[model samples]
Target: MDKRYVRAAVIALMLAGLTLHGGIASAQQKRDTIRIGFVTFLSGPAAGPFGVPARMAAEAVVEQLNAGKAPAPYDTKGFGGTPIELVVIDEAGGTTKQVSEFRNLVSRQNVDYVIGYISSGDCLAIAPVAEEMKKVTVLFDCGTPRVFEEASYKYVFRTRPHATMDAVAAALYLLEQKSGVKSYGGINQNYAWGQDSWHDFDLAMKTLKPDARVTTSQMPKFGSGQYGAEISALIQSGSEVIHSSLWGGDLEAFMMQSVPRGLFRKSQLVLVAGEPYLHRLGANMPDGTIVGARGTHGVFAPDSNLNTWLKTIYKAKAGHDPNYPAYVATLAFLGLKTAFEKAKLEQASSLKPSDDALIATFEGLSFDSPSGRATMSLGKGHQAVMGTAYGTTKLVNGKVTVTNVKHYPAERVTPPNGISSPDWIKGGMKPGK
Candidate 1:
């Protein structure tokens, strides 16, 4: 046989092997499971209230999706028939540790995507790394504006609105609910989320209600669990209203300590991250306390098919209603699912979509959630903007629940594209386009 003919035959055999089992084996070999790095706090102070709920939400959402029982628009089974495999990581240690875990997930575990990070610090540090590694990372509920406000990324996306909405809506809620709110003060954890929340709330107050004076401001070290000095200072300040963005154990500890000190009765308490604790804290929270669920989540979550489904399953397993953290985590997973199906369907193929395809399709994608409509309206269409809801807690029939719930539309609270939160707030916080 001629040398050329033998070489050509060998090439044909190799090509034929690539098409074995009608490309089924080849496809499976390429990618059988979609690995996702699901990062959230699983240990330490934040575990019980914040991280555990989020973890439960992830498990339920994944199980339902794999079972092909998720509500419409998200009814597709596990990223277009490819089962999802999650590598759950605890976001406990700090930003540095979280960053290291993220690289481990991407490089060692070989995750295709990442969806996690409840801390703003983690999100801020991970966003650039996500871009650098060219991986698709979805931020569930960090809320700080600094992530996208300072820089832009093609791979990093947030499925929920940032802290600006939470803080702005919080201030706007107070302005609408109260009269003669002439003075205010805050006791927030001294971290990115805390600092950002307090700053935005202060700025929004300054812009909305110019007369609202800052009687005092306190920044306690995170996880300190002791606010003796801060609470005493806030009580002495005699402010009409006291604001706090504390969440998880920190928020719980503050309420436990202050409620006994009669702080809530002395001054109106506005807990921006308080909706989850409404039931847990019960009458201890005091009636008329202002609360927000970050967005349209938890007690303020609207009635919908998606909401009912998630709530029923989550409550069954978690033994309590899914809170704001769970709701936000579900939103992130659903967003990823929506994006994956969109990218996959455009090809009309059974194979999973490419990272570039998913990224292209996800930008500016508007999708439904358990809460409501979420649009990729900010950060050059890379970040999400969702409506935020706030309400005052009322104890009725022995259960702590929100009354007088009011939702601020995404357009009203979220800054429009091409503008940062500070600029928008300074420019009068004009409604989004």
Candidate 2:
């Protein structure tokens, strides 16, 4: 009695299966946009300084690239005429959360690539995972030298020079600017980024001033917000100069806490990653303080067509000039764009290029950026090297201005390829002449 009913049910199931297959096939063939897994600290102490600016810059750059508004060499509409859609993820939680987030981005969301990580801890956690997954990942910020020195990954690359350059350039600037340079110490946040920065600076200072004593060194946890004890220790330790590579809200909080205690007034303060908060610090940034932007960023950025265009859009988005983090993020996008377009042009047959093809194009690739030209000349072309600049701050007409600026070449600051920063610094650090 149910023979006709059974046949009707079989036909209905077959039709449904066919419809699903057609839908899946259309999704695979008609997809014209590539999704990028963009991770940053959307909500955290680091958001205002590092994460927000980086996200803003990324949005601006991707929008311009999609519109074919980017300058020459990057004028192509997105990557090989394919639009880019960002699947933004917050990087506030610890490294474990970040690793989970990374997996979800790759496996669940199916992001074509990832461009993010403003923390060295996050980068370290994500790097091996990136290699394991064979997904292209670009690190925008996070200034630890250990990422490349400790290991190598084919799918991971950094667009910004590591923290070693920040400290090396800062030390060289200090020696050149001061006469005696008797004693110095540092206060760095307790993490890979902070530890690496302090280690490099300590070695550089020891190499440069053999007799100078280290009166005090403090390692505070990131976003501690209260540095009263550290400030008191540095002040009591009789250090003549204080060097700090702290960034984000931690850096700003240190200044706010240390200035009232007369720490900046009592001792020379060198803020290696302090250029971003120049406006927030304003007159509070302290005159005669040595400030560095990590690279040629902020007021230190050169006047170029790319710089002009980027600064205009970045300002409109960020409501202020682009800082080191913002510049580094945008540069990462530019580097990605340059490599993608170049790979596409070099091979017309491969419509969707393999990871190897893009990585091959990215290796040792040099590209024009808003700040200047960036070269992936270190870590066997897995890491980038860029010139760094340091300047003294001066309050003039109620605004903080960089005075007596000095620029150091990339060769002078960065360790050579195949040499770890510690080995390079400890072994007399031979630099290019």
Candidate 3:
């Protein structure tokens, strides 16, 4: 052969070698580990009381996934494969800090999916950003109704029940369970979580008991001490039942202060998100007080095999009873995994599986959570339609425990569409004089 022909042959062989190596690299990339951004209030007053439990749950779920433990019934992997590794971030600061950290996580760290957010304000702040960035954000604990009120984002999803759901459940339980309880009062923090919860609860009470009266409504600054004035006002209001959305340190302080002032003993007291306070308050909590987790309680100890297993694992890991926040993180991971697997199964030639596709799969998706079954709405708002647990607090084995747990379906409590919460409350349901 001529020299030119020999040179061409050598070049072709080198090109062929490059193509083979490239194929191997592409295969490796396909099997690359997935990265999930786990963000939450990891420091400050919220950490030990509420945020730390969430973080631990996230860590525990991730550990189980890596170990190939059976994912919850809602798991998308059909009970196989390791889940994506979580990239944790401390959202200890306020909303501004959360937005900055979220941007960094997505733009710089390049996380595949995001989970965690205990504060409703932080959730609302991050929702739009998550939409703009086109990342799948599973809000683990942000329950404020405003987060999904008017948003048209397809990527934002909440794995836990919304604030309205909690309020409605509380209202219904009061009406059905506590007959002859005529008047209602509220004491909530002034922020989004508190305001929304109070308004929603009011609406629910009005719907159930048209003559139910709201004697007093108070909003204290978030994390403020000295509830002396609020407690004095509540005592004077002559309300038979008082519902409060206070949590974290605020809750601890309120209970410590109010108990001594005889606020709870005066009448029926309902403490929303009360599970976190049980361990903190211990036997000091007032018995016969109505309290339950905001959306779900890990202490219910449902007879399901999954629940038993989770309780055992959680107890072994955390050395205490797991609260609702832990389940929030676990549910988030379950939601993402389900969505991703569904997207993969439904892959088409033109529409390959991507983050957007995974998000779309969340609609109408039902999964068995630590709390019973949870389903997502298909409309603009991707809120989880899950069950709520209700019960009165009791001292068991020298510990505060919420007993006589009754599961309430979400549909029965949530306000009907097109009605504002305030209007719903004011229309009727005045306490009988």
* Clashing residue pairs, backbone N/CA/C < 3 A, model 1: 143-163
Q: What's model 1's TM-score? A: 0.91
- Assess each prediction's global lDDT (C-alpha) against the native: 0.87, 0.87, 0.75
Which should have the higher lDDT, number 1 or number 3? 1
Instruction: Quote each prediction's TM-score.
Output: 0.91, 0.91, 0.84
lDDT of 2 at 263: 86
Q: Please give, for residues 213-323, the per-residue lDDT of candidate 3 as tens digits.
A: 889998999889779999999999988999998887888888888888887777788887787777778866888888878776576535675666667667879997678
Residue-by-residue lDDT tens digits, candidate 1, 83-127: 898889999998889889888777666788999988777898999
**Model 2 agreement with the true structure over 90-175: per-residue lDDT tens digits:** 99998999999898788667788999999888998999999999999999998788899999889999988888888899999998
In Å, residue 7's CA in model 1 sits off its true spot by 52
Error of 1 at 93 (Å): 2.1
Error of 1 at 365 (Å): 0.4
